[model samples]
Structure formats: structure tokens, C-alpha cells
Target: MKTISIIPVIRVLSWIVFLGLCIKAGAVLFTFTISLYNPPYAADLYQGLDLSILYSASRLDYIFLMAFAIILSSMQAFIFYFVVSIFEKLNLVRPFSEEIFLLISKISYFSLATGGIGLLAHQFADQLVKNGLVIGKAIDFWEGRDAFLFMGGVVLVIAQIFRRGIDLQVEHDLTV
Candidate 1:
């Protein structure tokens, strides 16, 4: 029986953490988008929902979204460290050594950064629009950011899967 190394265990755990973070970030963005569509009041007199309740719910939703972003960013950084550690243990794909992991980490960081920025921008733009201010471009920009964040989360997940595949391949080769 062959003993599994601590390194591989850590690598798998890191990927799991990364996957969780991505899911969380995605959920936050999705919730924010939904909140935008569900306004407090509608002229159609059928569903008698309380305006104050709806407003409070949306406010709470926004707060949760912001918190999710912060948590995801912290998890991303931890994942980055774990990725580098895994690479070192496997001694594979060291063309640029830690530099490659660093670059990937930067990409993750940027995605989270832009996502947070977009959320804040959207909030303010929404306020301006509610105030009867003419601000078309701000809304457009916020939408763009949301799109960027969603895409970024997807790309990161793909990358993590690819890396896991490589690890499995290495394990197979060692066994054979």
C-alpha cells in the first residue's frame, strides 16, 4: 500500500475551497441581479405586497452581497497560496515557477476587485435614477462589471478543474 502525501491532500482541499468561493461569489451576483428586477411597488393591483417590507428586504440583500464579495476575496488569496504549494510539491508546470501561480492569483484578485466596484457603482447609479437624475452611462457600466465578474468566476472554475485533471494524470502515471 502506498502512502498518500500531505501535499496532495492539501492540493485537493485547496481546490475545494476555491470551488466553494466561486460558488459563493456567483450566488452573490445572481441575488443582486434579482433584487434589481424586483422593485418595491407595481401598478398592477393583484399581488398586495408591503412596500416597506420589500424595501427592507432589498437593503438586506445588498448587504449580504457585499459580505459575500469580501469573504470570497479572502478565500481566493488562500487558494492562491495552496496552488503554489501544490505546484511545488508536484514539481510540474514550473516553466515560470511560482510566477505562474502568482499571475493566476492576480487574475482572481482583479475579478473580485472589479466585482465589488461594480456592485457599489450599481447601487449609486440606482439611487441616481430613482432621484430622477439623467445617468444612462452609469447603469450600463454597472451591468458591464456584473458581466465581467460572472465570466471571471466561470474562468476560475475551469482553471481549477484543469489543474485537478493534471494532478490525477500525474497520480495515474506514478501508479503505472
Candidate 2:
């Protein structure tokens, strides 16, 4: 039996995920915009906030936010590819250098840390807004557990990133 290369598989999966995220983001933006124009719906939606005032804000704001989220999601996907690449490259090398392996490990650790921080911030803000708490006050609710799931998600992804790094390192060491 022949083993297939993991890097190509990961790249394909990353592209698929990125495309799916793009589609979802587009649908969300469309729905949000349509909701604004429908009178009865718009009245209910904009009860406290002024519809005209919100619409007057640049459409680019929404576009930019969506784009940023897409970019972050894509980055998470690419982290998978990165691990696969490391593994493939390690297999090609007769024996991996300890220094290089250490560097790779450090890089993975930092990437995971950064992603975790970002995910935490986003989840915290989202929960604050979702629980009927004002933004300023919600932010104060670090004591709040409403966003525990989101925090868990961040931790889960970070753990995955770390696992990938460890797997790549092991594969590299064993292949030679």
C-alpha cells in the first residue's frame, strides 16, 4: 500500500473551507442588508438604534469586518497546511537538526498563542452583545460565563495547532 502526501490534502481542504466561509459571509451580509429595507422587520430590528444612522455608516465597515473574519478563518485552515508541509519536508531530510526542530516548535507555539488571544477577544465581545448587556458593561463582565463556549473553541483550536506541531516533529524524527 502506498501512502499519500498529507500536504496536498491539507491544501485542498484549506481551499474548500475558505470557499465555504466566503459563501457564508456573503449570505450573512445579504440577509443583514435585506433586513434593513423591510419596513416591519426594520422597525423591530432598529427599535433602539436609528436605522438611518446605522445605514449611514459606510457599507465598507460591514465588508471589512466580514473580510477580516474570513481572513482569520483562512489562516486557521492554513495552519493545517503548514503542519503538513513541515512533515513532508522533514520526511525528505535524512535527519532533522535539533535547532531547526526547536525553531519550528517555537513558531507553532507563538502562532497558537496569537490565534487563541484573537479568538478570546472576539468571543468575549460577541457574548457581551448577545446577552442584552451594553457593550461597555458587558466588557466589564469578565466574571460572566456566557462566552465559555467561545473560549473553549479558542482553546480547542490552539490545542489542535499544538498537536499538529507535535505530530510533525514526531513524523520528522521517525522517518529518518
Candidate 3:
């Protein structure tokens, strides 16, 4: 398939991912808000994921947990937004532009931030579990922390390449 044919497919997939993350973040926020007032709702926040034990143990912990979920999902969605933008700005014949470089760099930073936060949140969950909170499936939120970190590094390198590509393109245009 031509590269042009694939760009739209990838862009659509990115949009789907972005929308999914946004929905997830919204669901978590909604569940958290409801659980705060209803209490029993905490037993099954956002589809059968229970945090009631942690809720009963400490409201602060519960809030922090939900905040982590919201923040991570939102950050991932934000990263995908940049991904879509990158695809939108992409030109197969002239791929490197300052805007694309900035967008890629932004994605790298956001990915790194998401990974770091995920690691911290995972550690926090482990501590809670050790302390007898039993976060259960909630701890799975950061399961992709390592992957995000790796992607961040890779994207950072790509951003640097794009920067050089931009320089080269400018030089070529001047020579022509």
C-alpha cells in the first residue's frame, strides 16, 4: 500500500485511541464523584473495578488513586492528540517541519511524564497493598509504564531526527 493510504488509517486509529482514553478518564471522574457521595458506588467504580476497601481505609488514598487514573488516561489522550496532529501535518514528500518537530517533542515529553507518573502511582499502590488496602485490579492501571517510557525515548530520538531533517530541507531549498 502507498504510504498515503496508511496515514489516514493510522490517523483514524489514533483518533479512536484518543477518544477511548477520553471516555475512560471521564468514566473514572464520574465514578469517583459519585462514589464520594454514594459511598457504596465505590464497590464498583467504572465497571466492576472495586476500590471500596481503599475508600474505607482512607478517603485521601481513594482520591489520590482516582486522580492518578484520571491524570494518566488524560495524559495518554493528550499524547494521542499530538499524534493525530503529527499525522495531519505530515507531508510524505516534505515530511519535516518545525510544527511537526514541536508536536513530536511535545509527545515525547508527555509520554515521559505519563510514564514517570505511572511508575510513582504503581509504587504507591504497592505500598497501599502492603499496608493492607488490597487495591486489586486497580494496580493494573500502570501496567504499560515501561512501554510508555520506551516510547518516550524512541519519540525523543525521532524528534531530534526531524529537527535535523528540517535543517537539511532548509539547506537544500537554499542550494536550489
Candidate 4:
């Protein structure tokens, strides 16, 4: 039986992520433009949608909000890129190689960075609300970040396990 390599799957997923990033960029640009130019039309489009939170936003506020969304999307893209790197390294070399370990560590770091950034963004939004800049509740940027932080820590543990497997492989090789 031939084992299926996961490289192809990962590459496909990376392409999907790239596609999503492009779409998000376009949508953010369009949304910002609409919000700035036609408040009533924009409100009608968002009717019954929670984006009505944006109803009170000024043109500058819309620009700032869109910039925040772009930054968040970029961070998510970095996370996907890190996953692709790990998959590519695993495809080209031993799965237990040090390079894989380093890649996993990078995944952890990037995940942490994303979660931290989300937290900071949420805090900033809160401040904006407090200052009466954003009239309604700000979007919840930090809601799902706990999972990312946890996943980063879990990846570090998995990397350690892979390192131990490397040691076992070395021992088995030495026995020959």
C-alpha cells in the first residue's frame, strides 16, 4: 500500500489561504469605500446584519477599522504560511529533522504573536469606545485568540516529542 504524502494537501490549503487573503483585501477596500461614500446605502446593505455596529462610524473611523482588518488578515496569512513551511520541510526531509522542530517553534511563535496582536487590538477598540469615538460596541477581536495561544503551547510540546523521536532514531542507527 502506498502512503499518501500530505504535502499536496498542505500546498492546496496554502493556495486557498492565499485566495482568501485576496478576497478579504478586496472586500475590506470595497466596504470601506461604501461606508465612506454612502452611509444610508451602506446601512441598508448591512440591514439586519450585526455590522450595523458600524452605523455610527465616520469616514476616518471606517478607514481605521478597515486598516485594522487588513492587519489582522495579514497576521492570519502569516500563520498559514508558517503551516505551509512546516509541511514543505516535512515533505523534503525527515519528519523528525531539526528543521521541522524549528518550523514548529516558529508556528508557536507566530501563533502567540497573532493572539497577542488580537488582544492589543481589542484593548484599543475598548479605549476607542471609552473615548466616545466608536459609539456602539467595537468588534470583538480577541474572542478566539485563546485557542491560538493554546495551540502554540501544544505545538511546542509536540516539537519536544519529535525531538525525542530524533534521539531514538539516532540510537537505533548507532546499533547497526
lDDT of each: 0.52, 0.46, 0.90, 0.65
Residue-wise C-alpha lDDT for candidate 4, range 105-158, written one tens digit per residue: 787887787777777767766676786664332264346577777887888788
Q: Considering every candidate listed, which one attains the maximal TM-score?
A: 3
Each model's TM-score?
0.37, 0.35, 0.95, 0.66
Measured by lDDT, the strongest candidate is: 3
Candidates ranked by lDDT: 3, 4, 1, 2
Q: Which stretches of candidate 2 lie over 4 Å from their true place?
A: 1-61, 92-95, 98-103, 106-114, 120-176
Task: Measure candidate 1: CA RMSD.
Answer: 12.2
Provide C-alpha RMSD values for all models, in order: 12.2, 9.5, 1.6, 4.6
Question: In model 4, which regions exceed 4 Å deviation?
Answer: 1-7, 22-68, 135-142
Model 4, residue 148: C-alpha shift (Å) = 1.6
**Model 1 lDDT vs. the true structure?**
0.52
Q: Write the per-residue lDDT of candidate 3 for residues 24-133, one digit (tens) a residue.
A: 88898899899999999999988688989899999999999889988988899899999989888888888888999999999999999999999999998988988988
Candidate 1 local lDDT, 2-45, one digit each (tens) = 97668777767777777775665565445445544764331111
Candidate 1 displacement at residue 114 in angstroms:
1.0
- Which of the predicted structures, 1 or 3, would earn the higher lDDT when compared with the native? 3
Candidate 2 or 1, higher TM-score: 1
| Residue 110 alpha-carbon offset, candidate 4, angstroms | 0.6
